[model samples]
Target: MIPWVQLDSAKTPDGGQELRLKQRGAEFSIMLGTNELMNSRLSGSEEALAKLSCERIVGRSQPKILIGGLGMGFTLRAALAELGADAGITVAELVPAVVAWARGPMAALFDGCLDDPRVSVREADVGHIIRSDKAAWDAVLFDVDNGPEGIVYKGNDALYSAAGLGAARAALKPGGVLAVWSQGPDSGFARRLKQAGFVVDEVKTRANGKRGARHVIWIATLA
Candidate 1:
């Protein structure tokens, strides 16, 4: 069996936690304390987050999309694959090291998606991006933290709160989608999405293709 090797570490923006990159043979993982935030080998749900959201806005010409987290670049790559040449994707990654890892040890996993002409990477909080724009994005996808509970950084909990949902609603264009990925389901969060004036759809997806643990994806659309 191959042992996991630590490649690098970076402090969260809040400076309360550290994110470590570990590699075991060909597989890679980003860890926050003992919790594994993302793994290169298990990206099915992440990919689904982008695919399902983009499906909702595929008819729009040159759709503008905003991705909240860049975990392993799975969501970004999936979105790039689903959208046309004219579509634009803005990926807001809070931790600068995660972006650096994509260019470093995980470069092959990212597969040059960062260099795609249609994509722009921002080193800032996704919430700030959401609050700054008004009806700007056709789809807003979030794969931040361990769902809405915020395992890595406590500040991420705001992204799931009522105020956060309201900001997200304001950021989306009419009929736009807000897609979220979670390790498991939260009925309370689902209700919150509805309270925010979105038509919510809770989807169950597998973590690794057709196998492994089931994950949840919330597809919230504004009328």
Candidate 2:
């Protein structure tokens, strides 16, 4: 059995805790304390959400997208592949170390997508950015935390709240979509999106390439 090796660590904005990145051979994991929040090669749910969301939002004119996390850049790269040359992307990553990992060790996984002319990386909280902006994005795809039912951090609870959904609705352009990735189904959150005045669609996809654990992606449209 291979032992986990520490790759890097960063202090969260609150400064009360730290986010750590670890590697066991080719596998990578993100941790806060004993909680294994996410893993690069293991979390297929996030990747599926990114791909499906981009497919729905991408158009002939090219589009602008905001991705909430840069984990392994699977979503980012998948989006760039789907969107092609004309589209532009803004990636907001809360943890600086994750960004560093994207450029440093995990660069190949992203294929230098971060340096792509069409992509811009913002080092900030996604929730803050969503609240401050207005009608600027075509699609806001969030894979941050662990969906509405958070496991990595408690502060993430707000992202799935009614107020958060309201702010997200405000940030989107007309007909823009808010695509969220969740490990499991949350019927209550779907209702909240509807309560926030969005036309919502719940998509279920397999986490394994073949077919296995089901993951959910909530696509809410500001129609």
Compute each candidate's TM-score over C-alphas: 0.98, 0.90
Relative to the true structure, how large is the alpha-carbon lDDT of every model? 0.93, 0.81
- lDDT score, residue 59, model 2? 63
What candidate 2 gets wrong by more than 4 Å, as runs, is: none
lDDT of 1 by residue, 15-97 (tens): 98899999999999989899888888898999999999998997899899999988899899999999999999999999989
lDDT of 2 at 28: 82
The all-Cα superposition gives candidate 1 an RMSD in Å to the true structure of: 0.7
Where does the lowest 10-residue lDDT sum fall in candidate 1? 144-153
Clashes of each: 0, 0
Which residues of candidate 1, in runs, are more than 4 Å off? none
